[model samples]
Target: MATRSNQCDFIGAGGIIRDHNGDWLSGLSMNLGVGQVINDEAKRMLSGLKLASNLNTRKLEGESNLAIVAKLLIEVCPISHPLDNIINSCRHLINGFDEVQIRHIFRECNCIADALAKGSLSRDYGIVSVVETVSFDAPPPHAASAFTDDLCDLARAGSVRTRP
Candidate 1:
């Protein structure tokens, strides 16, 4: 769950909550922690353009299986969530895909995603693709680490999992 200050009003307010449940590659995670500094500096000057405007084509090189699964879930799924910030982000990320959408999952049933995240923390992976002139790739391994098990217990024991 998010902080109380941030309300869950998005239509797909729920998140998978992938909080480091696997045997992450500690070295990779540590390296990424440092690399993000450079990436942030490089990307710092690149935003504020219209939607789908990216300058780096290399960004579209690595697409991970987790993102593909998320994309799949968005298909043929029904959501009754609110219009919160998280959902807004998902919408932006999934823009132009008419068949895909965000949905609320109880988190207990999202353990697989959580495991993916933990695994990613140890290594960076992605498949890049292009839309229009913009280029983007699947979220990096470190970025994927942010995902969680949406309190659904799809695997594992309960709704809440401790980050490892």
Candidate 2:
């Protein structure tokens, strides 16, 4: 997510990694100082890809709320485009995976990640702090409710089995 104020532009990126069963494996949020929306989105993709690589994930199916970004990943990006470098990097990382696909989803379906990105904006981390990324083994407090809602929705859709 990207927000701009009179003082500065705040960019935050967050993503959740889930197994095929839809069980969360890990989550990440980053406070990326200042950047444009497109840049931030590309950075977010790069960060998520790096995290997945670090986790040694061989297959990946990434979902982005931004259709343009997802399209860029699957299509060739012009060298003159502002996000060319980042887009290329994302493609390079994707090649390392045994299988990879990036698709677009509606914002409503991406609540947890949106919450985490918003949470990054409210965090007390100093603007100039070197430590910007936060990793969570479980859902963070700010995203807990969204996480629960997601599970409930999945259960209702029969995508996942609810606990008895």
Candidate 3:
């Protein structure tokens, strides 16, 4: 999930479902028209989290680039932050899995999802304040062929691995 800092604030969230062997199964990308960067980031997390939860796959490992969001998901209580509502929603999604693990990765390793998100930002704003969801068989326009290799490298990278 990511936020596009432009004249019109945009939030982009993306998820790629893969098999146990790490083969890609499907992908989803959502673009939301919201100006707040934090809110957009939270929304992106929530959207991706919900998508994974709905898959009915019991054991799952989720990754995010935002440490704050991962921390909030682990400590669901406190609720002191302004984004408590969004954080709580993420907590609810985490409950769906029999065993769920969340970790934070470097921004560089999150290229595929980031590209999908940026693509959402560049898309035509139909309603100005609408959320658009797109499922792709191939990389979106914003993502290039090189991103595929980066995605593969990210899957194999062992740095900054966490179970937060």
Candidate 4:
């Protein structure tokens, strides 16, 4: 997910990887500096795909709150579009996976990622590089509540099994 600060043009991108059981595998927050929202979305997707590749993940499912980015991943991006290069790079990284799927999701359902992106804007991370993007093996303190809420929601929906 990408979030832009209303006070300035600063943008932040954040994402989380989860296991099939709804357990967090990893999380990322990057200070993308000033950029267009669409550009930040494409950059975030590229960053996520790269991270997943590093983890040697054979299969991946990615979700973005921006429908345009999700659609561009599944479809051809206009060559003249500003995000064409970044979107194509994302696609290239995705092909390295044995299987991959990208889809759009509602912002409300993506609270953890949203929180992470918002948090990034409040800090002075200063132009995060792809390899240097702030990564959390577990959700950070700021995202704890959203992560917990997600787990509870998943358990209640029977998407994640609960232990006796």
lDDT values of the candidates?
A: 0.25, 0.72, 0.63, 0.76
- Can you write out model 3's per-residue Cα lDDT over 1-164, one digit (the tens) per residue? 67574666656666565545554545667767666656766776677666655655667777677777667777655758888898888878778777777777666667667667767766665585667777765555566443456555633321111121
Better of 1 and 4 by TM-score: 4
Candidate 2's C-alpha runs over 4 A off are 1-9, 124-131, 154-164
The number of the candidate with the highest TM-score is 4
Clash totals, every prediction: 39, 0, 0, 0
Candidate 4 residue lDDT tens string, 1-164: 88877888878888887766778777888888877888887787887787777777777888887899999999989999888889989989888887777888876677888788888887675544432478888889998888898888742110111111
Root-mean-square deviation per candidate: 14.9, 4.9, 4.1, 4.6
Task: Name the top lDDT candidate.
Answer: 4
Superposition error at 106 for model 2 (Å): 1.3
Q: What TM-score does candidate 4 get on C-alpha atoms?
A: 0.86
The residue-by-residue lDDT of candidate 1 on 56-162, one tens digit each, is 11111111122322343344324553323333443354453323222233334443333332433333322341111111233234333333222233244111111
TM-score of 1: 0.25
Cα-based RMSD of candidate 1:
14.9
> What is candidate 2's lDDT per residue for 15-72, written digit by digit as tens?
8777676677778887766667777777777878888888788888887777898899
Q: What's model 1's lDDT at 11?
A: 12
Model 4 pairs whose backbones collide: none
C-alpha lDDT (0 to 100) for residue 7 of candidate 4: 88
